[model samples]
Target: MWKWETEEHAKAVVVIIHSAFEHHRWYAWLIEKLRVEGYHVVMGDLPGHGEEGKYSRIHDETVNEYIKYIKNLMESALSYELPVYMIGHGLGGTLAVHYLKKNKVACAGVILSSPWFALQKHGSLIKSALANLGSLTSNMKLTLDINKKALTNNLQGYQEMDDNLVYKTNVTVSWYKEIQLIMKNLFVPSTSQLAIPILLMTAKQDKITDVEQARKWLLLQSSTEFQFKEWPLSYHNLFHDLEREQVFMYVRDFINNTTRGLGYIID
Candidate 1:
């Protein structure tokens, strides 16, 4: 787990959820950016991810059980008694969406950066079938093939991603299946069911998640308190891209304006 607290009480607590095959510290830059803006932040790696992402080797389980781990993390942040907001990237962002759907907690808002709401445009149907089959396999240790280069266009970001201690070049097949299940469930629910504020971001050049699908979801969503932005020059790692300043500004202002007065400025 990773956390940063402001000197005084934070105006709002922002829980960060990292993308696949990466730990919370992958969000170090973003966390400090939010911390300077007076928001408390907490995040960690998911199972089979960081060195300590998993507490123990658990018995074989389904996707719902895997989601429970993130649910517990969300609950821990809510215990702070401050307005809770989520900043999730990629597959983690998808988890945040599912969390809000299954539970009716008073989440202040959610900011999704390249949420994995759907698979890549290529081989999506085949991937879905394979992932679904992988889900039911008794082999819990199976690994899924992944393309790391698609994460970011920045060379330094890729270097750091490779240097990370627990980084896995590929994720478990079960994890892929879980993501497939999440995306399906996420799309099946009525957009009208959402009640909290939502900030959905799409990476214009993302090769992993489908930006068009995310746009359609945002268009159909019922929450009038929502905002959307598409980073035209960014890759999958929006926070670590050359246009990161713009990404940070959107997040900082969203939290600041949502919890406090609307003093957000762009330009």
Candidate 2:
């Protein structure tokens, strides 16, 4: 786990959860942005993701482990006794939804960036059947074949990602199975509504995750204060995209508004 404290008095603590196949280092820009904006930031590499993936790869058994890890991070954020907000991207966003549904942690708000509720393309029937069978019986790994061009339009960002040593391109069948299980359960009606404010952003041109699925999930949320925005001409990684300044502005505004009446002082 890593914590970046702001030089100024903080208005709140923001815990960020990164997507699959990526690590905390990829979020350096976002972290510094939040820190400079007067918010303490907390984040870590997911299990079998960053430094951990060097030794062990993600398998079927790490599903519950991921939730436990997030719970620990959330506990650390709560220690500051400040209003807490969570930001989750891609698979990270899906995990955030799972964590919130099962746990009763107090969060002032949540921001989801292009959450991966469903894939943009599912392979042929034969391939799907084979994948299911492989997941049930083997721990074989499969290549994701993710296109860098589909991620962001920033050429510098592309270069940075290409040079990243810990960026994984393959995942175990069990890992895929676990992700599917979580996505399936996300649609089941919750016993209680999540009353906290939520901001869900999606890229209309995202070639990775299904935008329609994200929209459907947002409508099912019982939170009365939830907001959804779909950005046109953007890729899957909105934070690393060309309109990131505007994206950051929206994030700052949401946090400020959510905490306005709860003793949050604006500069």
Q: Please give the RMSD to the true structure for each candidate, in Å.
A: 4.1, 2.1
lDDT agreement with native, every candidate:
0.72, 0.83
For candidate 1, the lDDT comes to: 0.72
Per-residue CA lDDT of model 1 for 46-113, tens digit only, reads 76567754443332345575478778777878888888898888877887887777787878889999
Q: What value does the lDDT take at residue 20 in candidate 2?
A: 79
Clashing pairs in model 1, backbone N/Cα/C closer than 3 A: none
List TM-score per model, in order.
0.83, 0.92
